[model samples]
Target: MKNHQNPRRTFLKNAALSGALATLTSGVSLASSPSKRAVRRDFNLNYAPHFGMFKNHAGDDFVDQINFMAEQGFPALEDNGLMKRSLDDQKRIGAALEKNGMTMGVFVIDPGFNWKVALTTGKEEYKEAFVKECEKAVEVAKIVNAKWMTVVPGYFERNLPLDQQTAHIIDAYRMGAEVFEPHGLTMVMEPLSDNPHLYLRHSNQAYMICKAVDSPAVKILYDIYHMQRNEGNLIANMELCWEEIAYIQIGDNPGRKEPGTGEINYQNVFKWIDEKGFKGISGMEHGNASPGKEGEQALINAYHKADSFK
Candidate 1:
């Protein structure tokens, strides 16, 4: 049986999908040369790397990167901008992940999500857009064989009180939950710390929102980098939101790069998640600290070091 939802759409929305895939098949090596691996080894958990993270080693071909990740023992992948890619690319990547036994992690539900409109405004237009995006996310998830889609509830409304804004966000997410629950897809709410104006900035707030939504379809992303910046109690805050947390994303703070390049103690964090028996993907949603093959290898080595915890 074949799924026909997005088999061939040139793309009706604006996302980084095209930009990511446009260079996928270019065959350009970001490093001095392409990487050639002699063996494949499995990591401890399903830690997912994004598309261009290994372009130096894998070349610019997206499928080749997929192969390289598998060859390097990567068990999963996360594409934050995947929803913007073409349907063909989505299918190909999905097929590749399936063949390599790699899990597909979170991708943005809507590329138009970063705008200033508030879901907390109780505005019908904003709520409608959120619901539509949720519906589209279901279709996109089918194409990529993805179980999780990332969601941002939008910025805080300046005119609305904090409590009112929270309620509106909850109401909008409840509608989103209704759309996603039947498909068994989860919309993981991400509390970003990139800027101060954003609405959701803490794990506790996301946890409360998830509780308000009260559905398996809605959960928290629990990005380590953002949480570490927003608040210092990483382990405790995560434990508090543990029940509502559906996925995890990684980046060492001070620098949103791979494990060893910054202030985070990823080994401890990875070990903690491992001990907790989390069977979900930990998205490597950060940049390479070093450039070219050296950087890519460093990134890989960093993960290896972090995973060495027993």
Candidate 2:
């Protein structure tokens, strides 16, 4: 039977067996070798992830976290409480960021805000204090090579007239702008939506303040999460204040988690911003939906999907 078999059939059977053997060998080789490290993909936007967002995957060490973020191609970082971190830690983080070629995002300049007299009351001491904080922010910015710092005008003063309060806030920002203007640093105003007591809660409000300040050093942070809560028309509001918008922060509404875990259509928003040629960083200022490494990976995947928009 073998002698009578056709040459074509024999060749075909041999070829099939050889191909299977080669595939099996390749599988074995791959399985035996150490798994290749994942290559970082270039994201469409400079999405700034805060420290500790990837702690589960990268550990609690700041340098490790920064390295992990770089490995995953996160081009920038924003830490609202960066000034509160120890000077040594700040230096270490700055070094890590520099080594990884990452951009430093916004850090909170005034942690002691939220007082009635801070910026709205027009108190001389309060204004001086805000300006002093701006000075300190300049020093911190020098350390981290940061260009933007977040400034919250603080709570509303019930005793003061609304117009007077607005004027005071504007004056305070103008004074604050003086400190960083020489250093080529910007203080991006953040409008909070947590409570009615807090002042500067809308994009238009921030836009007006930025206009009043009339300096490149004073611009709006344009936090999407808070804006979505305070005013539902995100894209329109974004466009209204597009010119003065220096930086952007991102968090989905209902739950301040990653994009896909909430109601915000981040794909459209990202696409719109990209189409507009926005060269600023969008800080991922939200929490993860789940816990541990799996959740961190999910958050990364969510951004990849959102940024896939053409």
- Report the C-alpha lDDT of model 2 over 123-235, residue by residue, as the tens digit: 88888878888888888987877888888888888898889999998898889877876666778999988888898899999998887777767888998999999998889
**Clash total of candidate 2:** 0
What is the TM-score of candidate 2? 0.86
Model 2 spans > 4 angstroms off? 1-41, 111-114
Clashing pairs in 1: 17-84, 17-85
lDDT of each: 0.80, 0.81
lDDT by residue for model 1 (1-310), tens: 3232442311311122332222221222222332422324467767889899999988988788999898888877899888788999999898776656566889987736546875878888878888888888888888767778898877778998999999998899989978876666778999999788899999889998887766777889999999999997888888888988878999998889999888888899899898997767789989999999999999999999999998
Model 2, residue 42: C-alpha shift (Å): 2.0
The candidate that wins on lDDT is 2
**Candidate 1: Cα lDDT at 141:** 83
